[model samples]
Target: MNNLLQINSTDVTVFVFAGIIVLALLFGFIMYFLFSYRHKQKDFQLLHDQKQQIDVQKIELEKTLRELKSTQAQLIQQEKMANLGELTAGVAHEIQNPLNFVNNFSEVSNELIEELKTERQKTESERSAGTENDIINDIEQNLQKINYHGKRAESIVKGMLQHSRANAGVKEPTDINKLADEYLRLSFHGLRAKDKSFNADFKTDFDESIGKINVIPQDIGRVLLNLFNNAFYTVNEKRKSASDSYLPTVLVQTKKLNSAIEIIVRDNGDGIPKKIIEKIFQPFFTTKPTGQGTGLGLSLSYDIIKAHSGEIKVESKEGEGTTFIIQLPIL
Candidate 1:
């Protein structure tokens, strides 16, 4: 009976120890789960914060883009206004010559009319022999001068109209020779108007076989004018340091090939240095002094030619001269 009692007590002690061990294990598992859940929550918060930051950056980038676009628009508008102002000044300067001729001729014609009227009022006996014929000849000369001035004014107005019209990249059949020749003379006259003593030997070799090629007339005209203007400006600059015997000359030539048309504007003046020949077409790169060059002229010309599927190149020697060659496909 004592043995049986001892066994029962031992079994009860074992049961109590086993229950304590199970409780300890359960507590450890609950603590581990709690810590793991907290860690996951912290990670979630960090991820949410990063996403917010990215969203804010995206909004800021969009705002920056909007601002950039607005600024670009403003810059383009300013450029247009500047171009308009330049065109206005050029037209006004060019028209002065014809207007002066008209004014002077009008005054002379009026005087001649008065003189003829006076001679007519006088009796035939009082008037000297051939006086009437002399008065008639003078009046005819004045009328011719007035007519010539009127035609010149008309031509200037027509040219200005064509230049002002915004016919962007519209190609049409154009007489390349005529276009080249016209701009050559126009540029020379423009320089002469700016400086009374400016004179250059202008020459043209137009290929009759070139016929007509499809092109943007106004754009090409502007290109020619820019090139001719540059050529004239170069020669004139050279003339300043050159002797009186130095005759500034500009030559324009056109050639028709089986597949392409080539136009060349060459000058005998101070040439472009080799280093700068590459940068002449870059925007805002100019060899001229401030207020003398915008530097955008050649850049714009390059862009225009590129748009037309053509190529423009320059050849120069340091002390000789520069030649600009333009080649356009026959398509």
Candidate 2:
């Protein structure tokens, strides 16, 4: 009977040990589940917060984009105004010549009229026949001068109107040689009017063989004016720091081809640097100081030429000079 009791005690001890191990495993599982739940909750909250932050940031980005667009519009308008101002300056310079001739000839004609009136009052013997004829001839010439200049001024005004008025983008037969010459003088005189100290010598070599081609005269004129302005600006800038012997000069030449024409503009100023030469045609790329340039001249010229199925390129050597070549197809 004692041995049977000892066996029962040993079985109870084994049962108790097994029960304790099962309880420990249940506690371990509970702890693991609790910790995992907490971590998952924290991760979910973090993601929710990040999503809210991203939404707020997106709103701010949209606002910023709108503001940027508004600023861009303003700048574009400013650029347009600047272009109009330059063109006006050019027009004024061009018109002044004819106006001056008109005034001077008017004054001379008035003097001749006064002389003829005085001669008429003199005695028949005192009034020489030759004197009347000479005065009449001189007055006729003066009248012709006035008529010519008045017509020139009228033509210039008409041209200004044509440019200002809105029209369909139609190509017309344009004499590029004459167009180039006109703009060169216009650009030079406009610059001179703006800056009294500005002075430069210019040379032109126009190929008379290249007759009128179908083009938008106003557009091509604009391109030529821009190039001429840039050339003059470069030469003028160089003149400031250049030696006394340095002479600022701009050269414009035209060459005719069977299927194309080349307009070459060269300036004896500090040439463009090699590193930035390739980017010259890029919009908003400029080497000029702030407020000095809009950086749209070359970029616009490039686009205009490309629109007309033409090409424009630049060549430069630092501290020497720069040249721009424009090739336009004979379409």
Give the local distance difference test score of model 2.
0.86
Q: At residue 50, what lDDT does model 1 achieve?
A: 92
Worst 10 residues of 2 by lDDT: 160-169
Report the lDDT of model 1 for residue 319.
79
Highest TM-score model number: 2
Task: Give candidate 1 misplaced runs (Cα > 4 Å).
Answer: 1-156, 166-169
Tens digit of lDDT per residue, candidate 1, span 1-331?
A: 6656445877888999889998989998999999998999899989999999999999999999999879754543443344444445455665777789889988987887888889888987898658778877888887888889789778767866766664454799999998888677667776776687777888898889988889988778878877888899999999989999898999999998779999999999999998889999997788989977777678877977897799999999977898999998888
- What is the C-alpha local distance difference test score of each model? 0.81, 0.86
TM-score of 1: 0.64
Clashes of each: 0, 0
Candidate 2 C-alpha lDDT tens digits along 99-194: 999999999999999999999999988988899889999999999999999998897777656554444247998999998998888788878888
